[model samples]
Target: MEDQTTQPSPGSSSAAYPRWVLLEMNYKKNDEDEDSSCSTPADVKTLAAARTTSGYPIQVSLRLAEPPAASCVCLQLQVPDDVDVRYPTVVAAHGDSVLIQVTVTNDLGGFWNATTDHFVYNAGAAAAEPPREPSLSMLPPYYITDDYSGPQAHQLHTRATGLIRRGEDELVVAELSLKPARKDSLELKTAELLLFRSGEWILKRPRMSYGDREFGELPLWLHTDTVVPIGDRVLCWVNLVMGLLFCDVFEESPILQYVQLPMDPCYGKPSNRNVCVTDGGGALKFVNIFPRCCCGFVGATGCQRSHGVYVVNTWTLRMSDMEWVKDGMVDATELWALDAYKGLPRIPLSHPVVSIDEPYVICFLMIEDNKACYRDQTVWMLMVDTRSKTIQSVSLDQGERRWYPDTLIPSNVSYYLNSYPTSRSDGTSKSNGQSQIDIERSLVQVRDDDASNSMLQSSCKLSAEPAVQASEILAALQEIPSYGLDRDDMLKAAYRILSHGNGHRFRSLLSLPRNLRKDWLLMEIKASED
Candidate 1:
C-alpha cells in the first residue's frame, strides 16, 4: 500500500484540528447568472459558468465534521470551454491527488455524452503557489447512449469506469464491462477489463478465479455498486447485495478474484437502506445499519412500523488472509441516552458512513420522513462515536443549496491543504515535509478573527447587489419571488402578502384581492420573456 498523506501533529497550535474531511460531491453554483456585468475575475467567473457549458458551474466544497457547516471552503475546478453538459464525479482520492470524472457533452442538442478524467494534484495547496496543470489527455468523446444514430454511432458503448494513481506521475484508468458467455443465460456474462495507462488503452478479458467457494453460492449476476482503489494496484468493485470482486490491474495475467461478504443481517429485508464500504486506515471497513423494531424481531411482522430504531455494525477486512473481523456494533438506544444526542431528532438515519480516520466514529444523515418532501425539510449530520458510546457532534446539512445524491466521500485532502511546494531563488521547487508547525500556527490566528473567514461564507452572499431604483416597482415585484432584500419596500410588501393572517397590516397585498397581485405577476413574467 502507498503511504497516504499524514494528518497534523498533535502538538500543533490549532486545537481540535481535522484529519479526513467530508467532500460535497456536487459542484457549487456561483451567482454569476444573476448579473453578467459584474467585475469578477475571468477565471473565477468563467469556472463552471453557463457561457462555457450552458449548464451550472462546477465547484466542490470541503467541510470539517465537527465544525459548523458555514466554515466550508469552496474549490472551483478548471473546466475547458468546449463542453456543453458538464457532470463531474470524484472517482478516487489518495495522498494529494483527486481524480475527477467529467462526463461532458459538446452536443447542444443533447444527443451524446463522453468522459474526460481530471487529476488535481496537491489540491489544497497555497493560493500564492503557481498553478499546476492537470493531466487530461484522454480519448476522443463517445456517446453514452446506444440509441444515438449520429455520425459517431460506432463509438456508442456504456461501461463502469474507475481510476487509480500508482505513483507520483503514473496513473491507471480501468473500465469494466460484461459480455454474454452463451448458454442463453443473462447471468452467465463474462467480465472484461479495458485498461488505459502509459498513453495506451488495452482491452483484455481476464479470468474470474473463485477460491474455496461453491458455485451454487455465487451471485447470479454482477452489479457494481461502487469502485474502491484498494492500494497495491488492486481495484475492488463492490455490490452491496452480493460480494466484492478484486482485480490487480497491473498484473500481466490479472484475474478477477471473488470474496463473498458476511451473512447480511438485513438480508430478505430492505438491505440497501443504509450500507457503505469505506476505507479504514489501510483496510476495508464495511458498515451496515439494521432497522430494529421497538418490539424486537428485526422489524418483521407482528411489530410496529420500521421507522425509528436501528443498529450499526462494522467489520474490518484483513487483506492478508481475505478475512473480515467483526469490529463492534452500536445500537440507536445507546446513542439516544447520551446528552449530545438531544441536539438531533430521534429519527431514522440514512447514508451511514464510517469515518476513515477514526473507524469507530460513524457519520449519518437525518432527513425528512417523507422521502419525496425531504428537499423541503432540514437535513442534519450526526457524528456518533461507538467506542465511547457518545454523540460527537451534529450540524445542519445545507440541503436546499446543494444537489441531491452527493455521496459523502471521506478523504485525506484536508491534510494536504497546508502542504505546498516552496520554491528556491534558483527556481528549484521542493516540498517542506515538516512545515505543518507553521501552517497550524497561521490557522489558529485565522480562527481567532471571525472577520478573516469571509471565504467560508456562501458565494451568493458575497455577490454585489445589482443597481435597483426605488421607482422601479416592476423590478421590485420581480425580485420578490427570489426573497431578496435589496429593496426594503418590496420585501415588506411581499412579507405582508405572505403573512396576511398576522393582522398587523390592514391594506396588505393579500387584502387587495388575490387576482390583482396574480395579474401583476403574470404581466411581469410576460414582459421579461419579451
Candidate 2:
C-alpha cells in the first residue's frame, strides 16, 4: 500500500501546526481521476504544494515543544489544498490533554505572514475579561449675604445646593421684622435690629453714638418693610432720614455698610449763624438758614474763586468718633468734595443745589414760563453745589413738567443733565419737529426689542437645568432607605448623577412632589435607622 502526506513550503503564508499524523491516506495516479489510493511521501509532498478543488493546497506540518511522556501523541493536520478549510481535522486524547492546530495560508499575506505577527483571539474569551470602575473627589460649602432692608424686613439669598467650592460663598435669603422706637425715647436712643439665616438668627446692633457718649439719640426713626437682597443694595438709601433716626434690616451680614447724609453744612450749628463751610478751594460756602422751613443755608461763592463752577463737599465721621459731630466741635475743615455741576444761575435760592461728597445734599426747582412768548413756555434745570455755594441751571426745553417732581437729582452726584424739547401742537412749530420725536421713539423701541431678544437667548443658553437635575438625582440617592450609605457616599453619588445629563432639568424633575416625596420619606426612615 502507498502512503500519502502533505507539507507547506518554506516561507509559506501558513499557520504553524503541531505534528502531523496520517491514519488513512489516498492518492490518484492522474490529476483528474476520482478514485485515488494512498501514495508515498514524495507524492504527498507534491500534493501539498498543488491546489485542490477547494482552491487550497494540501499541506501538513508538525510543531512540537515537547513529546508526550507516555504512548499518547498530539497532532494537527494542515489543509493547504483547500483555501477556505478553516477546520480541516479534529484530534482528541482519551485521558491526556491534546493540542490540535489548524494551518491556513495566503499568497497575498492574508494569513499568519512573518511580516505581520498580529493575531486575533476568540470573542468569547475577550468578553469573559473584567471591567474597571470610576473614582471622584469632594468639596465643602459656605454662605454670603447682601443688600438688606429693615422696614420691609427682607433680603435675597443665593444658597448652594451641594458641596461649595473652597472659596465659594453661599447667599442667605430672609425676611425681616422692624419696629419703631417710642416717640419720646427716640431722640436719645438707637434702634436695635436682628437678622436671620438658615434657621439661625443674629442681632445687628446699630446705635447712634457721639464721640464721648456711649450712645446718642436720633431725632427721628424710620425702617423699611420690604425684603432686602444683596443685589438690591441701592434701595437701602430709600430708608428716608426724616429727622435723625433711620434704620434698615438686611438678610445677610454686610461686608461693608455706608450711610449718606444730605450735604448739611450747618447741621449742628445754630440756625441763625452765617456758617461759611468752604469747599477747600475758595469756590463755595453754605451761608445762613431759613430757620422756620429749615431751608436757610444758601450756597455762595466769590467771583475770584478759581475752583470749577459746581463743587460739593462731603465729611465722614471718624471710626474713632462714631458721632456726627465731636465734642460739640465739628471736623469742619477735614472734608472731601467734588465738582458736580456747571454754569452759574441768576436766582440761587429758586434752583436745586446738592453736594457730591459727605453731607451730600441736593436741591431741585421747577420753572414754568406762562408768558405768551415761545421761550416763556420752557422749563429749566437748576442744580446747586452745597459745598461750592454755587448755582448751575440747564434749560429743559419741554413745555411742562410731565415727570413726577418734574426733576430728579440722583444720589450718584456725577450724573449729567438730560433735556429734550416738546413739540407744541398749537401750530407754532414746524411739521419736522413732530417727525423727530417719532424717530427717537422708534429707535428706542428697536433698541429695547433687540436687548430683550438677546437677554432671552442668553438665559436659555445658560439655564440652570443641568445642575438642578444633578442635584435631584443626588437628593434621590440620599433619600434611599436601607442604603446604609455614609454622607461621603451620598455626596459622591449625587455628584456623579449631577455630572451627567441635563442637570437643571434633572433638578426640576426631582423637585416634583410625586417624585421627591417618596425619596424624602425613604430618607427619613434611613436617617432614623442611622
Candidate 3:
C-alpha cells in the first residue's frame, strides 16, 4: 500500500485525501491473466485466485494495494481459472458491498486437455465405463453479492436480487417484484419481496400501504433501474426517472417507503445523468447533473438545449422528515471561469457520482464531443469539490472496452483493501457495527401510512413577495449594451417564460447571448471570488 500520509494537491480539502476512490467496475483482463493450463487446487484457501470448487465460476475483488494517483481504483473480477475472460457487470453498490453478474459455460476443454498436469485418464476405469455423450447442460451464470468480510461465492439462479451480509456465513438475497395485484386489472399493481434466507427462499406479499402522494397509486411505469442495499435490513429499489422504493427485509411484514426525487423540468425524462450513493458515515445522497443551465440564467431560451455545459445539484435524504434537503449546486459557468478549468479540454461531461468519504466532492466522466459512440473514445475522470468550487483531481482512464458513466461507481472498499482482519483492530468492527445500526434505525421509522405530500416543489420556489412582470424583466434585458440577439426574438422568448404568474426573479446579465454570457458571467464569477 502507498504511504497513508501522502498529502493531496494544494487547493483541495484539508481533510484526508483519497478517502474514497472512483471505482471502475470493468476489470481489465490481459491474455496472461487467463491461464487455462492450470486447474483449481482441491484445497485452495486464499481468495487471491479464482475458484470453481464453491460452485460459482467467478469471484469479485477490489484491488487497491497501490492505488493510482487521483484517487482511482479498478474493481477486479477474477475470471474462472479454466475459462475465457468475461466481464463482470455491476448491478448495484452500497458501502463496501457490490452486486455483480457474470455468465459462465459448462465447456471444460481446458480440464480435458492432455497437456494439463491434472488431466490423467485411468485405462482400467475407462475400459469398464460406457462412452458418455457430451452433456449440453450449461452452468447457470453467477450473481455475486460481495460483502466487506470479503467476496464469497454463491450460485444464485435468479436475477434482480441484491445480497446483504449479516455475518461470516449469514447473508440475505432480496428481490423486488412489482406486478398487477390481479390478472383482471393492469392499473392496480402490487409490490412484493422475494427473500432468500436460512437455506430457503420465501416470497413475502405484504399489505400495500401508500405514502404521501398527490397521486394515490404506484407509478404505472415504475421501472426498477437498480437495487441497492442501504444498510441494516433496508434495501432500496430505485427508478432514476421517478423515486426510490425502500423496504426493511427484517420486518415481520415488510412495507415499502416511497421517496420521490426532485424533478428537473428540462429533461422531464430519466437518464444516466443522476445517481444515488451512500456516504461511508451512513447517509444517502442523490446527485444530479442538469444538462442545462440553472444558476441566474433561467430566462435564456436556448439554455435547456445541449450546450455542453451543465449545473450539478445535490440533495441529502433527511431520514428525519422524509424530505430531501438541497445540499449544494455548482454551475459550469462558475467552473469555466476558474483557472483550474483552463487547462482541461472543454468536452461534454456525464455521470455525476458523489464521493462516499466526502459527500461534497463529485466525480464526472468527460468525453470528446466529436465521438459519435463511446466505443473507443478517450475518457477522463474529473473530481470536483463543490464547497471549494475547485477541481480536486483529473486522471486519464485507459480501458479496452466501451465506457459509460454507469460503469463507474463510488465505493469505500479501498478502505478495507490491505487492512483485512489481521491488520484491523477489534474496536474498528465494533464502531462500524454501531454506526450501521444507527443508520439502519433511520429507515425503521419511515412508515408508508404517513400523509402523502409533495416531496419536491418546483425548482424556483416562489416567495411571498409581489410577482415580477414580463415587461419589467424585458426592460432590464434591454439595458445590456453588447446583446447580439435580435430585440423581438429576445423579448418573445423572455415573455414566454415569465408570463406565468409565479414570481421568477430574472437576471438580465445571465440572459445575454452565448458570446455575451461569458463576459458578464466571468465578471460575476470574479466578484464572488473576491
How far is each candidate from the true structure, as Cα RMSD in Å?
22.5, 43.9, 15.7
Model 3 lDDT at residue 188: 62
**Span of 10 residues, lowest total lDDT, candidate 2:** 116-125
TM-score (all chains, Cα) for each model: 0.60, 0.24, 0.59
Once fitted onto the true fold, the runs of candidate 3 whose alpha carbons sit more than 4 angstroms away are 1-19, 26-50, 53-61, 65-86, 94-96, 107-160, 166-170, 182-188, 212-217, 266-272, 293-306, 369-374, 399-402, 420-530
Give the best candidate by lDDT.
1
Clashing pairs in 1: 28-59, 48-57
Q: For model 3, which pairs clash?
A: 212-452, 213-452
Better of 1 and 2 by lDDT: 1
Ranking by TM-score: 1, 3, 2
TM-score of decoy 3: 0.59
On TM-score, the candidate that comes out on top is: 1
Greater-TM-score candidate between 2 and 3? 3
Candidate 2 error regions (>4 Å): 1-208, 212-379, 383-393, 397-401, 406-530
